[model samples]
Target: MAKAMTIPDYHPYQQAHLNKPQLQFSDIAPLIEHYQVQPWLTVTELGRSVKQQPIYQLQLGQGDKRILAWSQMHGDESTATAALFDLLNYLQAPEQAAWREQLFAEITLYIIPMLNPDGAAKHSRVNAQGIDINRDALALQSPEGQLLMAAAKQIKPHFAFNLHDQNRFHAAGPYPNPATISLLAPAYNAEREINASRRAAMQLIAHVQPWLEQQIPQHIGRYADDWSARSFGDTFAAMGISTVLVESGAYRGDDNRQMARWLNFQLYVAWLAAIASDSYQQADVALYNAIPFNRSGGMKDVLLQGLTVSIGDTTATVDLAINLALTGDRRARIDELGDLSLFSAFHQFSVQGLAFKAGQAYPLNTALSLDTEAHLALLQQGYTHFSGDKALLQASSRLPVLLNPLRPTQGSPQLWQGATFLLVNTQGKVVQAVLNGQLISVPSGVIHNPLGT
Candidate 1:
């Protein structure tokens, strides 16, 4: 069916620089068709979404050890999908044909590239049925889940990969944003008993550890191994399949996830090569804990400081916090605009003024204790206190708060005054909707900007 191209020792980064694009489901179809070559290499439609879009499966290799890998379980998670595509392209290359040929000669590979095609197109987390496919692995309520489960049952691969994209909020310790990336050799059952299958999975992760560490050391982490009945990797591991969960998450500086994308491809290539080598007799599990813990670097896109706003009947100097979606440029992308919510918890601010000294974090739970010296510090930093009565709240209940009476809004998309409900292109500087109570500026440059203009 699909013709294999010739590629040399293909470097994943080089290929990514050439193939990185905001890919859609349609763009992968031709490539899929091109790879459907040979009697052993077969392609089939696993099922269709509610929208009637076909969910395709490509199978290569027919050996004793089969690896079942799926991508785009969350529609918005596309880094794994891109890595899978690049792997295919590399496998088809003239120089890399031997690797494909040798691997297929012994092992069978079943790939469902973009399991949630509908979600991939819409770039949402849930599938067409509004159910998370990962959670549905055990429930098997949605057709997508059923399709994947049925395929797993029929093929019963020795190993599996649950690929996804996590948020940028996760840090490599407690101070860095853009969690370099994390992996999980999911535990099975209530006790998290490590059986042969779990061991197999760990070996795989251990194998990729060297390559990943060399590329991005002091990053990479082991996800919490708590077992969840609803989670796919957990369920699969419980059922005796060694499922390795690969999370393609955020990277520092490169918000569009381009850096993560390239790392993901390299990781996958190293993983496949390791699997083919069958060298698992000497995997060191102790290295798992050595993976650095992600840190949170205090970053705020828009800081409004030292403004006397009326809270109920009292006028006090209030600070406004706006958390932005980090994408594209490190400064501020147009789409990273979000509503400023009221936060009543102790927030660690860069703190250079406003009743508070530098490095001082205040609990917004109580009334303001204004200090002119602190206020001057904020003003010097070009910090303008928020204007308007609407306060958007993003504080979680678990966060520490000194006072509770001044608590702000919570949950995703909480709205606040002077906060833009809609993100607009401020030419190049981040602009907001309802600016000064009216639409301001206009969009220019990149159209359909994925990293938010």
Candidate 2:
């Protein structure tokens, strides 16, 4: 009888060189050259993108079972590409010789690090032809799509890994935590039936779920099983190959997704080990089904609850939900107002008995500047609002004030300027306030403000 192969700890082998969240084809060119000289790896030009950028594939191991993995199908989603390179770095390290030998003896690996180099270079989601390669899998209209299909035909892999990144809004289950990582065994048919291929994929996911749960706690999300004939994952599964979809999502406090990259490397090693040792077969597919599905619209960046507002004759109490828009700039906007009881918040404030007032009017000729501290000082004084140049308002970070230059009607304050909500408690005392989706503290006591205003 043979002894069980012990899976090595992945922490020591984790590649620390690639830490950035964004990557491009040019960024990996040097690394590719470095790997070309290795004795155990075979580097080949799979094809070229619409922009004439070379798409390369790296092949390693000499095992009987074959596995195919690709990353950066969408150019903007570069985290998985970073992880694949990290994995390559680990595989070529002299210290991992024993583990590499065992893995190579049991399975052969084929990897396409950046399938859509054209889109990657421009930081776009689609190829240079403005077509999404994943959706073009069956059409084969795009060169990248055609190249991927050709590679799949030549490798005839037993298993496939489709890697990508998702938006930060997704939550793990319905919990407050963000979905740090998500996985899926794509459905093979429109009926969403589970065949041998999908079953195998599910079992592998099940085997990795426990370890991932231990690592991320309530941050693992099992992607919903949706069958799309044009998608590569479903199409490959329908072709009788076990396919797994891995989506890197946002983790708390790690905006660059560096932590997500490390987690991806860990997952790759675990999946490869399970396949090489046949340990995935022992895993229960039901466990995969049991993993929580990703949910959306659960929480916002900031929330203000219970305030009375008067615009001339009408007065009403409302709650406000504010969110930060990711436009490579510092600008927070009011996403919703009025009863937002269904939603959760990263930062919440209560002003149950406070009277709210909008910002005061500023002269049109007033000189505007990008002084954040000066703007915040104005808020600290009694003025709740100020209308000025859009550029200066958008550039200021110290100002806890909203921008609404349009100055909409009182009832419909859609784009009202300096839309700060001054919260005055009963007995005519100003207790707390909300500015530009952030809460501020008054002399009476501190309000629950996450932005530290």
Candidate 3:
């Protein structure tokens, strides 16, 4: 069993141990204190979260090129929150202070350190009212969204930093590849047209890309510039704010998202350099197209063979897949797999394996490598814990491929329709209850006795 973690009370060089330590809300209090003491810093309480926690804006530099950056709008995604603080600390170092001063001097900065304080406190993506603040850009119904809007209106920052995080399944370049950092210079509206907003955002991304690529080459990505009404990035760009969508995406085995925090600091530093210099504006915006879309390949935790089981009385069979333990407090649908996040007392029934039907769009060619004896031994040991009404399990050496949320949930489960299982009943016929849907595997001690008999 993984030990229950006890994060340190405080970390001097917070950025250095982001991945190692479990961060908490209390950890940020000292940072606020530090910022308060800085002569150049101007911390503002723009508004409050639904939970009534103060939302702060940290402004630095007094230049014409006003830039705005925010983090943790999705409360559970706190890597950027850590990174922003780290960036501020890095600027305090004597060696980097000169360059940092010049950058800040030329660019007035607006930073909302934690946009969704309520969500951050609870470690959830949604605000206190359970509304996804990202999708509330237009509605502005939630206090969190309203506060962000109010801040934006007040600052009128020329360039906006729309920061968030993504899942582990996202590959940097494409299938079988991992992108340590993914960036999106989001396009305005539905057309995906290259306007001033996108160009400005893309120029900044392009400037930062070279530096990031040099550090973690072939692992930086350009996000899909898709348009959505409630999307803050799209709306900000539509309002001509020149928004750059910074997605702190997946890194291997870093479930707590510390690697993301480190990369974010690097990106922020590079971003400051870009903003300060204005060097990338002349570069071709077409460079943004060269980045590959992240693919959901080689990211699953478990794969299974054919699994047939019964849901109540109806027999449902499919190739079962499971992604190992994912740690988060909120509920998010497995859009690709079409499974509801079901919770049980001992274990949660969230399927991880990519479900696909034969001759369908399921993953092909890729295989899993498992020792038969060891696998069987593990299964045998696990079997002792199987005491449910119906169970179907199969193991395979294939990566999971989830269907995108574009499909219906019913169509999603169709991929797993060939699984086999054994049924158990707590009634009189213990032995006979172990039977397949087609009356196969009849235990010898079992007798088919009618209720009347």
Candidate 4:
């Protein structure tokens, strides 16, 4: 009845070069430069970041229903920014003229693709001043946050979109699969009483869920709506603006979030089209409420089950939950252990009956370099890693090359330590190797991302 709400498939319509996780100002300058000259769009210098990088706003359309959307308030979150550029590229194409004209006749769009260039340059969540712009809504400390508030006051938009990237480890429900995309209609007050503004946001998210379900079934989630007074989404909702938060998370092999980026791009198109056609009024709020709440920490990247450990002169069976670190370039740590039956993992290796032990490090002088086959061979020999200067170790090796060799432990896996070790059979043959954070099957010798990030 709402004309199906089908958008062009993302893979073919994709035109943005957004396959990178750490996007900098330099990476996006070209896209902004290209859009500035487009006759159908209006570009304005909104403000500058703390490091003096220009932050621009892009505007289009002329009808009464005004909407404001922005991305990259946390510089490290750039999936939404890439999707914005991809959306712009598709909108500017002549083939979409008819749809664009019709949409423009009913609504106007104000978009900020990147709000924290300095933070982006450093691949950090905080701006150059080390202040989180998202949390600056009330304090108005960061200039980027100030610019956003000023723009909202000036525009008084009917709706707002707060775009972001959530942790890849967040799950849609009790399952191990990551919640690739999460939507939230942020609550305004402590009580979180639903008013017309919040209701509208909920209805819109409900309108998009069916289409999203078809794209990635059971992988969509609703963000926890605990009111955070300092966040723009919460404040905007308090101001009577319907604000929808779109969190682009990760997919299996999509370490760069390309899958999430494509979904974000297509989702935006669907949202604008639904607004233009008055289709959102038909959405059932119950569907939105039915969406699964995003579950966190209940899931991990890898899990080793029933491992035999020798600690305190006693042998005990345990389980370990491993997850890649977010701060470092690529490193994993043992997140937790014990029963862990309630938790789910992306990579689960049952080391039942296998004994866990500290892995031996190859001599730095003798093994300064190694090939994939040699790495696999060494893994079989209980050499989980190599010791050498990082610069001297080539990227060609799949095994982790530690600059400083780790001290020998008591042959017990320690919680919160780097996820690197070996699981050996009763015959003392290494059966599995957890390198960085990846589970490598010793028999198959299938190597995964060494950093496990």
Clash totals for all candidate models: 48, 4, 21, 0
Winning model by lDDT? 4
Rank the models by TM-score, top first: 4, 2, 1, 3
246-347: candidate 2 lDDT, tens digit per residue? 999887667678778888887788788889999899999888988899887666666677767667798878877766554344455667778877666666
Tens-place lDDT per residue, model 1, 1-453, is 001111233464243432433445786777667666545468898989767778889887767788899988788787888778777766666666777788777678888988888887776888888999999987799888888899899999888989888765555554334456788889898898789989888877776676667767656766777778998899889889988888776654455566676676666666666677676536776655566654433233344444223334654444445544343312221122222233211122221122211111233444343344443333233222322222332323221111221212211222332222222121222222212112211222111122232
Q: By the lDDT metric, which is better: model 1 or model 2?
A: 2
Candidate 2 is scored at a TM of: 0.85
Off by over 4 Å in 4: 1-5, 326-329, 364-380, 387-398, 401-403, 406-410, 448-453
Question: Residue 69 lDDT in model 2?
Answer: 98
Task: Point out where model 1 deviates above 4 Å.
Answer: 1-22, 37-40, 293-321, 326-453
| CA lDDT, every model vs. true structure | 0.59, 0.77, 0.59, 0.83
* lDDT (C-alpha) at residue 349 in model 1: 27
Top of the candidates by TM-score: 4
> Clashes in candidate 1: how many?
48
lDDT tens digits, residues 1-453, model 3? 000011111234355544522344566767887787788778877877777788888988888888889888988787788888887776676655666678777898888887887887777889899999999999999998898888888888889998887766566764344566778877677888888777888887776665566666766776677788798888888888988888886654455666677767766766666677776676566666676776544344333233333444665434333332345411112222322222111111222222221112222234423333433332222211122122132334121212221221232243323221222333312121111111111233222321111
lDDT comparison, 2 vs 3, better candidate: 2
Candidate 4, 1-453: lDDT as tens digits? 243345545555565566787788888898889889989989999989888999999998987888999999999999998888888877887878998888889889999888999989888899999999999999998999999999999999989999999987788875567899999999989899999989999988999888888888888888889999999999999999999999998777678888898888877887888788778979999989988998986568787889898777898888888867756645677788788887777777788999887787776664345677777788787787666656666546645544453433226777777778888889989887877777777867665544424
Candidate 1 TM-score versus the reference: 0.68
